[model samples]
Target: MDVVAFKQFINDQIQLFAEKLGDAKHSSNDGVSLGKLTFYLAVRQSIDKKASEQDMGLVGAFNDTLQALGMVEPGKTFMSKLDT
Candidate 1:
């Protein structure tokens, strides 16, 4: 997916989870914490060797977008299941 689409997808997922956790107003620090927790969990899961191909692809796209936006160093790896 393109960068814009990827961002939208992330936002949508976060919003869905926030709503599920009773953060429909999304005005609480707890909501932010939950979002961060969810994101990290997804990252960890994506880097697992047994992760689905789709999960890996999503994480790769996320890392690529971060690099492209200068949020991460170019060619710097985040999580590599092979390194474990």
Candidate 2:
């Protein structure tokens, strides 16, 4: 499939899976959606994997620092200057 088709397919699958999970299983009671949590976890896992492969702790540390500073939030890819 083309890149666009593949992306759409992935989106459709995630939507279907989310719908199957519904509100109860799809999200925690903290109001964070499962999609957001999943995205954050995926990013963390990728960072960890890269660090492990490269034998560098700085990558993970950088991720942690970003999280601690609230520069990276679940499901948020960019911090808009206009938001504040």
Candidate 3:
């Protein structure tokens, strides 16, 4: 999908999750944790040598959403490698 479509899909997914989790702050904590887990899994999948382009796309999409939401700094994502 194109960038716009991908972004829209991500936004929709986020909203859906939020709605399903309800407005209760305490209940939403689990949703946040689930999101983090999903992100880490995507990151790990992206780094796998056997990963397909689709896997990397998912990682990129997740990173894009994070950056868009200001949850991450520009050009810095879980996929970024630290300088040794």
Query: Which window of 10 residues has the lowest lDDT sum in candidate 3?
Result: 40-49
Of models 1 and 3, which has the larger TM-score?
A: 1
lDDT on C-alpha atoms for all candidate structures: 0.60, 0.47, 0.61
Tens digits of per-residue lDDT for model 3, 1-84? 544454455566655665656656647377675675455455444544455676677787878898999888998874453332
Tell me the lDDT of model 2 at 70.
Answer: 92
Residues 1-84 of candidate 1 have per-residue lDDT tens digits of 444454455567666666656754555566565756467446555533555676577677878988888877877744421232
The local lDDT score (0 to 100) that residue 41 gets in candidate 1 is: 47
For all predicted structures, in order, the TM-scores are 0.43, 0.30, 0.40
Which scores higher on TM-score, 2 or 3?
A: 3
Regions of model 2 farther than 4 Å from truth: 23-84
lDDT of 2 at 16: 60
lDDT score, candidate 2, position 58: 40
Candidate 2, residue 11: lDDT: 64
**TM-score comparison, 1 vs 2, better candidate:** 1
